[model samples]
Target: MHVYSRRKRKAGVSDRGARVGKIERTTYALGWRIHTVATQGGLPLTYRVRQANVNDEIPTLKLLIEAVRLLHRAGLSIKLLIADAQYYWKDFFKLSRWLGIKPVIPARPQIKKTLINLRVKHGFIVEGDPELIRQYHRG
Candidate 1:
């Protein structure tokens, strides 16, 4: 978010922390990168604020690791992590699986259409994750 202040320098905005990044979808402004992890019910679980110019994928890995650490320490487990397309990365998927969580992120917009086509050609789609399949059978 771009904070508009009349002052020559905003408080606490260092040369490294705050930089030029996109805001309002059409404008690039100086601000911090804000990333959030939320629940399926739209509740925020954790977040990170970093330099605005940082790449979208960098802080996400840290967020996921931190989330796993905090949740597991509290006697909870993350079965699935649903993120947006920007979070689609092979290494991220591998790390999430290693952490015992399934990453449900689309690689591209066409993935939805492809999956739909598969379901149309075949009556049902098979579940690849063993844990999810077992849960389906148990229910």
Candidate 2:
């Protein structure tokens, strides 16, 4: 997210959460990071805005937990969860499985070759591409 520094601040105020992060190789901007857990139709279930430099896993875990709890109260369970390769944390995925969610996170190239073809919904699944997953798990 790009934030235009348009507003003037108070005399003794500090830029608390505002931060600078690289937008591109040669470009940079001061802005916050937005983390959201939403449905397939793009309806946001939970969200958080934090400093750009903050680790995504922190708020991501919080958002997922919040969403899951809400859904559980409504008697619904998440069957499939699609996330970025950057979210491939062992402990995180373990917690997701304990909650009975099927997480589909792409394996990074560096670890793809080392990963086994486990079909467990609790652990990492190597096939992230929809086409590849479909090809292997034919219906």
- For each of the candidates, the C-alpha root-mean-square deviation to the true structure, in angstroms, is 7.8, 6.5
Clashing pairs in model 1?
none
The TM-score values for the models, in the order shown, are 0.63, 0.70
On TM-score, the leading prediction is 2
Model 1 error, position 137 (Å): 22
Error of 1 at 58 (Å): 1.8
- The top-ranked prediction according to lDDT is 2
Summarize candidate 2's per-residue lDDT along 3-105 as a digit string, tens digits. 4232246564546567776655487666777788887667888888887667777888888889999888999877767665577777677878888877666
TM-score of 2: 0.70
lDDT of 2 at 100: 88
lDDT of each: 0.63, 0.66
Candidate 1: minimum summed lDDT over ten consecutive residues — where? Answer: 114-123
> Candidate 2 overall Cα lDDT vs. reference?
0.66
